[model samples]
Target: MDQPITRRDFLNGIAIGATAAAASGPLLAASMPDPAARALPGASPLPPAAQDAFGYYPPLLTGLRGSHPGSFEDAHALRDSHTWPTATDTGQEYDLIIVGGGISGLAAAHFYRAQAKTESRILILDNHDDFGGHAKRNEFNLDGHLNILNGGTLEIDSPRPYGPIAANLLTTLGVDVPKLIKTTQNLEFYQSLGLQSGVFFDRETFGADKLSVGLERGPLKELLAQAPLSAAARAAIVQIQEGNIDYLPGLSSDEKKQRLSRMSYEAFLRDVVHVEPAVLNFYYARTMGEWGVGTDAVSALDCWGIGLPGFQGMNLAKGSIRRMGFTPAGYEDTGGSFRLHFPDGNATIARLLVRNLIPSAVPGSSAEDVVTARVNYAQLDRDAAPVRVRLNSIAIRARHIGDPKSADQVEVTYLRGGQAFTTRARGVVLAGYNMMIPYLCPELPAAQKDALHKLVKTPLVYTSVALRNRQAFDTLKVHRVYAPGSFHTYFHLNPHVHVGRYESPKSVNDPILVHMVRTPCKRGLPEHEQNRAGRAELLATSFETFERNIREQLGRTLAAGGFDPARDITAITVNRWPHGYAPEYNPLFDPDVPEAERPHVVGRARFGRIAIANSDSGGAAYTDTAIDQGHRAVVELLQG
Candidate 1:
C-alpha cells in the first residue's frame, strides 16, 4: 500500500472488521482453544453495536468484507469435510426455515408467507454480517457527506429481457425501474463536463504508459498516436473497431452463430481476422466486466452479443446465441435488461424486500425513500415477527427427522460465533451456494449430492474507493478508465444516482466514491477451471496484498492526471467473494445435455419437504433469477 498507510491509520481510519484471528476453516474441536480467543489485532475497533449484530450495519464497516475473517469459518468447517455437531437443540421451530439470507432466501420467505397461513413462521439464516447475498452495498462518509456505491451485482441486466415471475415481484416490492432511472440516475452528468471513457495502457503490457481519452470519438488515427502501441497493433485496433468488413460474409446468421459458439473471441480474432499478437491482449480483458473471464474463455457469439469490438461488420442478427462458457450474458433466468441499477445495486431490492417483509426493519413506504433509510438491524430477527432474518449464522446440517418420503419436520443445525445451535422447520429452503448444499444435507441422495458438488461459483471482487477528490478525473476528462493490465480491470467514478434523502457529490474538488471490478482467473483455463483457480487465489490473499495491488494500479493509471494515491485516497472497501457469482452452466466445461438433465436442474429437484432456491438453482447469476428461483422453491414446498 502507500507509505501513508500506518498501524494507527489501519486502527483508526480504516473500518476493517476482520474480527477472529484464526484462519477461516472448520470449527475448532470442543477441547481446542476458542477461535474468538484469537481475535485479530484491533478487531473490536468498530462500535460494539455493529459486531455480531441484529443491528449489524455493515455498509458503514469498510476494508475486508464479503467472506471476511469471522463470516465464513463455520461454512468452511462444513466444506472441509465433516458434518458439524448438532448436539444443542435450541428448542425453537419455524413453519419454514430458509438457509442463506440473500436475495433468494429473503424472497423465499416472502413467497412462503404469502402462500402459506398468515401466521406461518419463517426463519432466514445468512453467514454474512449483512443480508442481500452478493447484492452488497458499500457506504462512505466523505467530508460530512454520505456516499453509497454497489459492492457487487451491478444493474438489472440480462441478455434476454425479464420474465414474468421476476418482473411481477419487482412491482410488488414497489421498484419502478423506469421511474427510478429517470428520477435517480444522471447518466450524462460526467458527459456534460466534457468527460468521456478512456483506455489506460499500463507500462508492463505496452511499451509506454498512457491514458488515451475519447476513444473512437475523434479520428482513430490521431488517438492511436497517443496510445502506447506499435504501429501494426495500432492500425489493427483501428480497423477492428471501425472497419465494416463482413468477416463471415458467405455464412447465414445462424451458421455464423453456431461457428462462433464453438470457438472463442480470441480464436476468431487471431485465426480469422488475423490481428496482431498485441491486439489480442488489448481485447483480452474486454469481456472481463460482463463474463468475468478474458476473450480466450468467452465464446465469440456471447462476446458479439454483449457489444464487443470486431463484430461491427459480421452483421449477425442481434439475438440470443448459445455460449460455450456461461449463459449469464444473454439469458432471462431472472429479470430483464433494464441497464440501470439502484445506487447500491440490487441491495436496494433486498432492502425493499426486507422493508416489505418486516415493516419496522426499514422505515419507508416507497422505493425512493428506502435508499437512505437507516436500517434497524435489531428489528430484523424479532422472535415475535412472522418473518425473521438472522445474520452471522451458517447452517451446517439440514436433515429430515424421519423417512424422507413421509417426514413431518426437518432438523437444521448451524454455527455462529463458533457455537452450534439446532432448530427445526416444517419445510426448508436451501437458498445458499449449491456446492455447499451437499455438505449441509448429507442425507440427500448420492446422485443429487454429486450433481450439487459440480456447481462451482466464479470468484470476483468489487472494490469501493473513497477519494479525497476526483479533480484528477476531471482534469483528465475521463469518466471511466479501462485498465487491461491493472489488478482491477475497470475503475470509474460512482454513478450519479441519488434518491430521496440521498444526494450524489457533484463537485470535482469534493471527495467521491469510485467503483472498481476485479475478476481473478487464469487465462488458459476453462470457465469452471478458472473459477476454481480464482477461488483458491482469493481465499489465500490478504487485505494488505489487495491494498498494495490497488494502490499501485490506481497510481500507475491516474498519476498523469495529478492523482497522488497516498494523499488523495481516503478509504477502501474490498468486497471479496471467494464463492462469488452463482454457478451458470458453461457448455465448454459442462456436459451437453437437455435442460431437464442439466446438473443445476437435477440438483435443484425438491427433496421431500426441502427445496433449493438461489440464482444457482436456475443456473444464472442475476437478481431476477434469484427471485424466480425463490418463488419456485416456495411454490414447490407449499404445494408438495
Candidate 2:
C-alpha cells in the first residue's frame, strides 16, 4: 500500500541530507559544487571545434570531467535513501554481471569467459560516459594530426613482477612485454637533448621563483645550495646527506623501527634532521605525490620506503640511501625505463579487452593497430553479442534473488537515463570500489560492510595540458620539473613513444602534451580523514579554477624558458579522480597484521552469488592487482 519513492524524491532527499550535514560543520559547508552539476547538459550540442578530425571529443575536454551527473545522482541517491524505486524487469539474463567497466571489470569478463570455456552471456555495466573507467584516453588533434595521451592509469611498472593470473591476462590480451619495453620512452634521447630533472621553488613558498637543475650529481647538497634556506638549515641538510647523526647517539634496530613508525617524517626532519620550515615546505608537495599525504602525516618509515632520504645512524642499508637519489637505482640502471605503454597509455589495454570481448565494438586485430582503431560505441550493447558493455548505466542495487544457501541467481538493478532496469545473472562481480560495495549490496554481513567502508581511496589529479609546441621545455633543458610548492607537484613532457601509427612529438616545434600530477592530502590529519578531505576538495574544484591554476603555475615556473601561457597552451583536460588510487597498507597507522586478517581481505570474501574484484580489494593500485583480483573473483564465483 506504500507509494514507491520516485527518483526525483530520492535525489531531493540526498541534496537535503547533504545540506543538513554541511550545516553542522564549516568544513563540510565549504565543499565544492556537486561534480554532477558540472557535467555537460543532456540537451547541449557538442561544439564543432571540440570534435577532432577523428570525430571524437574527449570527455575531459567537453566539460564533463569526472563521474557523469546521472551516474553520481543514482549512486548518491541509492546510498542515501537505502532504497530504490521499483525496477522494471528487462527480461534479460546473463551468466555474469560485472558492476564496473574499468580495468578490473573488463578483466573480470575476460576471466569469466576463460573459466566457463563457453561464450556465456556477460554484461559489464559502467557509470562513466566512456568504457574505460580510470584508464581513460585523451586524444588531441593539432592541425589535423591526432595526439593521444592517457588521462589516467599511465604505465605498467615491471610487469615481470605481476602475479601469474595477471601475467596470463596480459599475454592473452596480446600485450607483448618485450615489445612494450622496446617501444617505451627513449630516455637516452631526452638526455642527449640536455633534458634533466629540475626543481622549481615558487615565489610564494620561497620568497623567490628559482629553478635548480642537475640534482643527480648530489641531490641533497645541490637542492640545499639553491633552495632559500638559512645557513643553519643548509648545513643541517648537508650533514644529514653526509650521514652525520650525532643527535641519535645509540638506538637498537627494534627501537629505531618503533620510533620511526610512530614519529612523523616532518617531526623527524625538524627535530631529528634539524631542517628549517622552508625545507619542510619543499618536501610537503613532493611527499604528497607519493604517499597521498604530507610529511607531517606520513610516518618516517613510509618516507624511507619510497626512497625519501632522512634516516641516518639507524643502520639502514647503504643501498637504501643510494637508491633514494635523484635517478634512483632501478630507473637509472635501465636508463629510466617504464614498461607497457600505448600512445594513450594503459587505455590501450582496456581497448584491447573491449575489442576481444566484442570484436564488433572496435576495428582492430593487434595491439599495434588498436591504438588507431575507431571504437563502435553503438555496437557495445548489442543483444546478439555474447559479451555486452553498457556505458552510462550505474548499478544501484544488487541483491540475492532468494535464500542465500540455495539461490543460484542474483538480480542487479541499475539506473540509466532516469529509468531503473533490472536484469538477472547467475553470478555477480562487484568491481567498482571497495567502499561503494556496502551500500550497493546492503544484504552483506555487518562486519564485512564495516570492513569494506574502512578501505579509503586516495584522491589524485592527472592533468594533461596540450601545448602548441615544446619550445619552452627545450629551452629549460629539462623534460621533467618537480614543483614542490605549486598547485601541481610535478609536471613533465610526456616521453616520446612510437607505437603503430602513433608517434609522440619528435621536434621541438611539434605540439605536445605535458602531464601534470597532483595528490590532494591535508597535513596533520589521520590517513582516512586526509583522504576524505582530499576527496571533498577534488569535488569542489571547478574546471575554471583548475585552468587558472595551470595557467598561473606554468607561466610563473616556465617564464625563464620562453613559455607564454596564453599563446603556447592549446588545450587543457583535467582528470579529477576523487577516488583515484586504491588503498595501500599504511606503515604509520596500519598495524603489522597478517594478510588474511586485513580489512580488504576479509571484506572481499565471496558472498552468495557474488564476489568482489578491484584493485582496492587486493590492496594495491597496480594494473596487475586489478587483473589478479578479477581472476580470483571469477574463479571463486565459479567454484561456489
Candidate 3:
C-alpha cells in the first residue's frame, strides 16, 4: 500500500529524519513556478514586470538587481524551513559536478580534465541565464554596427607576476601576451584625442555643477585658488600634490607606518594633516571606484598603497613631490601603458575556456578569434556531451551519498525552469560566492560555516550606455571624469583596442560605448556592515531609478558641450552586482592572523568528495587567484 522506495523518497526520508519537520506548503508554493506555463516558448525566467525591454536578465523591477528575487527565494525558503523537495534523480551521473559556472568553476573543469588525463564527464550549474559570471560582456547593434563593452572583470593585470600555476593556465588558454601588448591602445594616443582626466562637482554636493580639466595648470588650480576654503586647506592640497607631509612630527619610520595603517584616510587628512572640511570632502570620493568605499572606510596605508598622496614618509626629500597617479604599487606602467585587453574585456577568457571544455558550445581556435565566436547555447547541456554547462540552474543542496569517509559519490539538487532536479557525481566543487555556501551545505561543521559567513562581498554597478556619437565628450574636452557625489562615481569612453576582427571607432561621429561605474558604500559604517548596507541599497534600486539618475547626471554635466541625453543616448544596460568584489584583508577590521589560521584557509579544507574554489577562497579578487584556487580545489579532490 505504501509508495515504492525511490531515490527521491529515500532522500526525503533522510531529510525528514534529520529534522523532524515537514516542508512548509506556503514556502514551497511561493518558490515553485507553474511548471506547465514555464514550458511555453518565450516564457520569462522572471516575473513579467521584471523583464526590461532592452536589458539582459530580469531587471529587478521592484527588488534587488544582481542576485534578484527568484535566484534566492527558493534557497532562502529551504534554509528557513529546514525542508526541501525530495530531489528527483534524473538517473544522470558525471565525473565531476561544479556548483558554479563562473571563471573559477570553468577552470576547475579544465584542471580536473588535466588531472585525469582524459575528457571527463563534468556538469557546471549556474543561477544566471548567461555564463561568464562577473566577466560579463554587453553587446549592442546600433545603426547596423556592433558595439561591445565590458560589464565587469576588465583586464588581466600584471601577467608577469602570476604564479607558475596561473601562468601555465594562461598559456594553455592560448593567451598571447606579446600580441596583446601590441594590440592595446596607447594612453598618449587617447590623450591626443582630447581625452584627459577631469572632475565634476554636482551643484547639490559642491554648490555648483562645475567641470574642471587640466588640474595641474589650467582651470582646476584656479578654481581651488578662488573656491571656498581656508588657507590651511589650500596649502594641504598643494602639499598632497607635491608629496610633502611635515605635519606629524616625532615619529620613527616604523611608528609612522603603524599610525597610518591604523587610522582612516579621512581621519588622517582631518586630524593629522589638519585639512578643512572641503578638502576632506574632495578626498572622500577619490577612491570609491577602486576600493568600493570612501576614504573613511579605508585606512591611511590603503590610501598610500593606491598611489594617493599621503605616505610622505616614503618621499622624505623636501623638494620631492609624489604625483597623484592612478597606478597601484608594484604594477607600474609597462611602456607607459597598463595592460592588454579584449574588446569585451576578459569575457574572451571565459569564452576560450568554454570552447575548450565543450567544443560544441563555441567555435574558436584561439583567444583572438573568440571575440566574434557565436555560442550555441542550446547545445550546452546536451545529454551526449561529456562536459556541459547548465545556465539558469541554481544549486540548492549538496550532500554526500552515505558515510563521509567511505562515500564514493556526491549528490547535488538544483532548480531549473521552476522545477527541481538531482544528479550524482564522483566529486563536487563549490566555486560560487562564499556567503551562500553555508545555506547550500548545512551539514558543514559549525566553525566552517561561521568562517564562510565572515566573508562579505562588495556591491558594485557597471553601466554601459550606447551613444550616437562622441561629439559631447569631445566638446567637453574630457574623456574621463570622476563624479565624487553622484549616483555614478565615474564615467569614461570604452578602451580603444583594435584586436582580432574588431576595430575601434575611428571618427568622432562613430557610435561609441560609454562605461560608468558605481560602488554603493554607505558612510559611517564598518567595512562588513557597509558592504551589507550597500547590498541592500543595490537590491532596492529599480531600473527606472537607474535610468533617471543616468539621464540627469549626464544631461547636467554635458549641457555646456551641446549634448542632448534624450537624442544621443540610444540604449543603456545596468549590470548590478550585489556580490561584486571578493573579500580581502582589512587592516582596521581583520586580525593579523597567520596564513594557516585564516578563515578562508580553514573553511576551504576538503570535506569528503567536496572541495572549494573561488576568489573568496583565496582572499584576493584577481583573475589569477581564481585560477589558482580552481587548480588547488581540483588537486585536493584528486588527492582525497
lDDT of 1 by residue, 106-183 (tens): 888888878886679888889887898888888887889989988877777665567888788888999888888788
- Looking at candidate 3, what is the lDDT of residue 208? 71
TM-score of 1: 0.90
- For each candidate in the order shown, give its overall lDDT on alpha carbons: 0.77, 0.71, 0.69
Pairs that collide, model 3: 64-539, 242-321
lDDT: which candidate is best? 1
Q: How much lDDT does candidate 2 score?
A: 0.71
| Candidate 2 residue-wise lDDT, 1-640, digit = tens | 0111110000000000011110111111112222233332221121111111223333324333545334566776776875656878888899999999999999999988977967799989998777778888877777677788788777675312666787777788888888767765564566678776777877777778788776554456766688776777777656655663544448765466557667788888888776788777766664565456667877775555545565555665322222112112222233222356666778988999999899977897888888888786656776677898877788988888998668989999987666678999999999998899998888899999998998999887777788999898788787777776777777878767777787777888989888787777776788889889988887787666667677777887788898888787777777777887788776567766777778889999999899999989988766878888988899999996
Stretches of candidate 2 off by over 4 Å are: 1-64, 68-70, 82-84, 158-160, 217-224, 241-249, 252-254, 317-338
Measured by TM-score, the strongest candidate is 1
Q: Comparing 2 and 3 by lDDT, which wins?
A: 2
